[model samples]
Each structure stands twice: as structure tokens, then as C-alpha cells.
Target: MDIKRSYKGAVEISVILLFTVMIFSCGKDTPGTIEPEKKNEKWRTTAVKDSIGNQYYVVNTLDNKLEIRVDNKEGKTIFAEVCPTIDPAEIPSEAAMVITGVATPNKYISINDATLVLKIVMDDVKIQKKYIQLLANINLDTKKFYTKKYKIEKPEDWTIVDYNNVVHWYQNTLLVREGTDYDLNRGGGFMGLGQRGTQLVCYERDFTIRYTKDIDANLASYPSGSGGQYIPINNFEDMAFRSDGLISRVQIVTSVEDEWAGKKDIVWQNDLKKSSNIPADYSVRITDYNIQGDEVIASYTIFDEKGNVKYKRTGKWALSNGFPRGYTTE
Candidate 1:
């Protein structure tokens, strides 16, 4: 009897141990309740102001750091830097910084040198900052190269205007190509073509620069051609020249053998109107015209249809992408 009781107690103990082991094993094997390893969901991000503002889309990878910068009225870049992409909401309200920048969360970001108003969202919290950086670089003479973060939106004439009358077209603003007239003095016969933002390239040297609206930045550039954008060069006509040395109108005479369309295409003719030069403090000059890397300036005069002067603005001429070395006469 004693031996049987001992045997039964051992059996009961073994069963209890087995049942406990099974219960623990079942807890570990449950599928739905298993926890997954933590991962980062911050990838593939974008900054959308009201779903329609300038979107700073993150590019292919997120390993790159953010670049912030500030530029003057011209498209020249100023100071730039790399920073951690923190949630703007996490920044202290008393934090001192300037951060006017566009963000591409997947890739990087670039900003101008100015006191910016940034509303950053990180971890579902919005943080704001002021005095993010030094704002005096606008007048600085520095040529800084920044990683182009902003994917320039193609310019559409009809879709981008504000009640205050601000136009934000940023693509194909100017075209540049090899100049037909080669100068022995200048090594590269490179001439830039400024034109209406519609076409990608300028076929001929004669073209018109139409600012869709009043852009007071006194913008200028030695426009360059794109990698593959072709331009039509048919139908040439002689147009009148404005008071300035630029052509007021041009005549397009279609070549018998159209480079674009073989066989004498439709004989097309178009007329150009005179471009009213607004009073500006900068003069648009051909590339290499200014020899001094430190000394070049131009002026502009904005006038109304009646030829009445409306406004006069001034900008420093920069030969080497640095600060304006000089200015133009009024």
C-alpha cells in the first residue's frame, strides 16, 4: 500500500509539471498576440501646407541629412547646413532659431538664410521655432553649393497666383546654349537664351522673356539648355528692335527643309511686341562680358504702357556667383 501511494504521488506531481509546461508553451505559441519588432514608419514623408502648398517630398532614401539655406532675390544660394530632422513640435517654445525651408522627408531639405516660421510635425505633435538661424546672410558675399532638395514644380501660367498677386512659377525660367557667334577671346562660345517659360529651349538667339507677373527680384541668369529638351527653329521674320539693343519683334521664316518636320512644313509667321523694360538697377549682360570677377553691375527701369516710369530697382552685378561687386546707373 505504501509503495502504491508513493507511485500515485509521483504520477500526480509529473502530471502537474507537464500541464504547467504545456500552458507556458501555449502562451508562447499564440499567433495573434505575438509582438513584432519595432520599426520606423517615418519613411516616405512629405510636408504639405494645406495639401497644396509647396510640397517638400522626401526622395528615394532617408539616410541623407537635411540641408538648409537662404538666397537673395537672385537664384544664388547663400549659407547652408545639415541638421537632424526633429519634429517641429518638440522644439521648445523659447528656442531661438530661424528656419524658413522646404522639406523632402525621404531625402533632404534646403532653406534660405532668414528668420523662418517653421511648423514641424514629429510624432503627431507640432513644434514651432523662431530665430532658427542668422538672417544677415542676404547681404553676404558667399557662393554656397547646396544639395538641391526642392523638386522644382513645373511652371503653369494658369494655376499659381495669389490675391496679393504673387506668381510661383519655378521651371525652365531661362535657356542657354552654345552661341553661333564664336569669339576668339572667349574660349567657350556659350550664350544664354532668356525666353518665355513655356518652351524648354530657344532655337534662335532672338527671344522674349515674359515674367508671367511682376517678379520684383530682378532675376537674371545665363540660361542653359536642358539635356534633351528640343526647340523649334522654323518660320523666321524680322521684328522691330526696342530702344534697348534687344529685338522688339522677330520674323520666323520656315526653312524649306524643316529640321523638326521634314518637307516644307506649313509656312508659319508670328510677330513679337516690344518688351517694356522696367526701371531696374541691374543690366542683363551676355556671359563673359564682365571680365572682373569682382566688378559688374546693371540697372533696370519699369515703365507703364504710356512709357511713364513706374518703379526703379537696383541689384549688384555678380560675375562669379559671389556678392554683387557693383551696381548700375539709375
Candidate 2:
């Protein structure tokens, strides 16, 4: 009787093991009918938008040759241009011609309509003809003035004389001044000099000037409840065109005192004025203090040679504003 019972238990265990194996085997093969791999789908595409709201789609294969599609409003595709084959090494870092991406060992075409080429190059080193699109031009009797052109289209090369005569090339865009600033005429439009999206700025001769910190002493003697009152440096933002003719550097100076009367309670530092100074002229004059109260407000203004104000702004914070924080660990 004992042997018969043991044999029955062994058969039951064998049946359970067989059922488990069949379940796993069935899972390995999906239930649906297998389809053949597709071969005709040769190219993959990705779409990007420029600053001007134009849409560009890039179609590419594994070997890296490209076809670009530019679409306008109403969803109509306007252009389909084939990009020339290029070696990665021959491309300039700021080449507005080449799209940029994370270049890997495989060297796949990662980005198609990237607008970063020209501006990126301008940021690092100077170029010869940095063509920029004309944003606006004023043909005055005295001097021609240009404004709001894009950076990509700035000229690559230029020669200026004593901040009076100017000449520069931005890509296909050009700005020339034959006489003094008063005699120059400032209206012309061009394309291929800037990013695809932004409104074009008018072109002008590249020039430079010396700037210094303008501080007020009497305004520096103010009162405070806990910490000393503020000192504003909103006037120090200045924009300068590069030697190549693109408005490249914007220098900003801020004034904030860390301690007052040896009491060190309220810290004063205002880097907040940097962004506010963008619209004003490259030369800035900041008024350091207020006459009514110890609370200081920095004022900035752009002026003509005769000191007529062209643009002006006021700064909000001092250097004492606490350090802002946020960063990704990865």
C-alpha cells in the first residue's frame, strides 16, 4: 500500500512540471501572425521651427545625406532642397549652413533645421561676412540708422575708421559708411544674415567707445532700518558690435554694498539690471541715488551726442538680493 501511494505522488509532481514548461514556451512566441520587415522606408524625418515661425522638416538616411523641407503658413510645403554631402571636420563651429546636434561615433544626422550655426560661431570667434537680415533702417538727413537685425546674417569682415566711418559684411548682408555718422544714410534690407525665425535688424558700420562706472557720492549717504539702503547701477549696461560688425558683447555693471556701518545684516547686490539694459544703447549712465529717500533706484539712458535721451530704464534689485538656485544633478 505504501509503495502505491508514493508512486501516485510522483506522477502528480511530473504533471505539474510539464504544465509549467508548456506555459513558458507559449509566452515566448507571440500569438499574432508575423509580418515581413519593411524595406521601402529608406529615410527618417524630423521637423523643427525657426524664430520666424517657419517650419522646416529634414529627411535623412543612415549615411547622412539630407533633404530639407521648408513649410509656410497654411501647411503648404514651400521648399525641398537637397543638402550637399559634407565631412564633419570641414564644417565650421558657427557655420550657419550646417545643422548641429550631439555628434556621435556613428555620425548620424541628428538635427535638420537647427538655427544655431551662425550665432554659435559669432559667440566664440569672429567671422568675416556675418550677414544679418535688416530689421529696420532710418535714412535721416544726418546719419543712417539700423536696428533690430538678426545675428546670423551679420557680415564676416569689416573695417572702421575712428568710429566715424564704418564698413562690414555679414554673410550676404553689407553695411557701409562713406562719410561721418551725420552724412551716412541708413536704410537697406538683406536676407541670409540671421536666424530663420527672428525679425531682421538693419545693418550699420561697427564702432567702439570707452565706458566707465558712473557712481554718485552724495547718494551713497543714505539711511536704513536694519541694513543700509540700496545703491542702483542700472545705468551700466552697454552693447557693442564686434569688430566683425555684429552686436556681440553687452557689458553690465551693478553696484551693491555688502555691509553698512560695520553691521553686515542686510546684503546689497543687484545683478537683476543686466536684462533690463538690453534695449538701451551701448553707453549707459546710471543715477546712483534718490533725492527723496535713502531707497536707491538706478536709472539708465541712451543719448545722442548732444545728450538728448534716446532710451532709458530703471533697475529693480541690488546685489543684496539672495542668490537664486536650481540645477540638475545629472
Candidate 3:
């Protein structure tokens, strides 16, 4: 009987030990626990090739750093750089960045056969409600890097509007839109009331990297004595971009008092003088415009208060010198 009890106790102990081992093994495989192999796994990886058969690999590590590798056509590792954290998914395949008020696409990272341009946004802890935008241009041929930094203010109430497809990279020039909000009050004393509206601003930055406010126009306006009503006619129209992504031309409606005052002179201005190097005397009221090769053809019209088209003429301007010499108006 002693031998039998001893054997049974040993068997029970063995079974308990086996069960405990199984429980511990299952616990290790539970949802919250990280497997040994996956502990060092990467968050994401992206691989792309440029036009000249240069291979590029972008890896997003678990700690939010980007590991970028470039290989030449001969499969030789030519360049490698570790950049700040930017989600691999945000980078677009195209060369242009489109900020449509809702989301800013990864076109911020543009890679071409000769150059790689990166637009990075960094927070500024030193300044309240401000941020820094860094533009890094890398020459793939020479492996040289150049950087431009822009300090931008962050407004609490303003928002980005896709705003006629604003923001583009025109060769060495950059065009971007900045939006602002304004409060307008109509009437006087106790009967006065206030309204809010957004102003869409178009800014141009040349190769010198200086920002110029090209157009400061509103999306809508609440005219005084109009009972806080909004009108959309006082906005930008016919924004056209060149083949190289430059805002070739834009038309601004200075006022829409014609809607209320019966007969108001509607002025249309061509705001591309500085960018295109056009002369200031060039007529701003261009009606129809087209860009063909290196020349720009535009039409102008003059109308009487009775809505009669009094005069119509067409002119051709050269983009090379911004002169109306090659072509004549009809």
C-alpha cells in the first residue's frame, strides 16, 4: 500500500506540472504579449524606383524614424539618409503636394531623377502658435543637400481651403495659400451685428525663398448695411497654372457692388505680372487666355453699363521677355 500511494502521488504531481506548463505557454501566446520574432519587426516599408532606374527604399521603424536608401542602376548603394519621422503612407508618388484643407498629401516628398525635395513640418516650442516648415532639396547627381526654412504662424480659427487647388512647385518657385478669418460688423450702436468670413490669400515664393503676398482676397464678404448677408461674387476666379505648375494667371474681382448698385465697374486684374516678368502697363483685364509654347494669348473686353460689349480685342504676350512684340492683337 505504501508503494501504491507513492506512485499515485508522483503521477498527480506530474499531471499538475504538465498542466501548469501548458497554462504558462498559452499565457505567453496571448493577445497582449509580443512574440519574440515580432518584437523587432518594422512598422512599414516602401520601395520605389526613379526614372533613371535608381532604386529607393523607405523604412518606417517602430520608434518613428525613416531609413531611406538609394541604389543606382548598377545595383550599387549610392546614398543613404535617416530623416525625421514621417509616415511612409503620407508620401505621394507624384511630384506635387496638394493641401486640400482636409488633408495634406505626401506629395511633400518629391523625388525625381536629378533631385529629391522634402517638405518637413516641425513644431516650434519657443514660439506660441507657430511652426517651422523646412524645405530640403537634395541633388541626386552630386549628393548635395540644401535646406530652406520658413516660419509660419498658426491661427486658432483659420482653416485651409483646397482653394482652387492651391500650392504647387513650379521649378524653383513655390506657390502656396494662407487663409485668414475676419469679423465684420454692420450698422451702429445697439443695432450693430457682427459676421465672420474667411479670406483666401495666395503667396508666391521665388528661388530667393522670399514669400510675397500675391493676392489677398476673400472667399466671401458681408457687405455693410446688407443685414449681415454674405456674397460670393467678391472672390478669385479663373486660376490657371502653367505646364511647369506655376500659377500662370489668376483673375480677381475687386468688387461686386454691381449686384446692389445697378451699375458698378467690375475690374479684372491679371495678378501674374511679377512672376511672369510682365510689364506693369500690361492690361490686367484679360478675358480669355491660353498658354501655347512660350507665348501667352489673351483676350480683353469692355462692356457698357447696359451690358453691351463695347470693345473686344486679342493680344499675344511672350513669356521669354513678357513683351507683346511677336504677335499682334485682332
Per-candidate total of colliding backbone pairs: 46, 45, 1
The C-alpha TM-scores of every prediction are 0.20, 0.21, 0.31
Those runs of model 1 whose alpha carbons end farther than 4 Å from true positions after fitting are 41-330
Ranking by TM-score: 3, 2, 1
Write model 3 residue lDDT over 240-264, tens digit each, in one string.
4232212233333222432343322
Relative to the true structure, candidate 1 has a C-alpha RMSD (angstroms) of 22.8
The global C-alpha lDDT for each of the candidates, from Candidate 1 onward, is: 0.27, 0.30, 0.38
Ranking by lDDT: 3, 2, 1
Strongest candidate by lDDT: 3
- True-vs-predicted CA distance for residue 1, candidate 2, Å: 99
* Residue 226's lDDT in candidate 1: 24
Global local distance difference test of model 2: 0.30
Q: Against the true structure, candidate 1 has what lDDT?
A: 0.27
lDDT of 1 by residue, 1-330 (tens): 999999999999999999999988898879866786442222323332311222322211233333334333343433344333333333333212222333111100112211112322222223211112111111122332222111111222112110111111122122211111211112322111232222222211112443222211223111121211112221221112222322212222222223334322122211111222433442332111112334332234555566665554343433323243444344
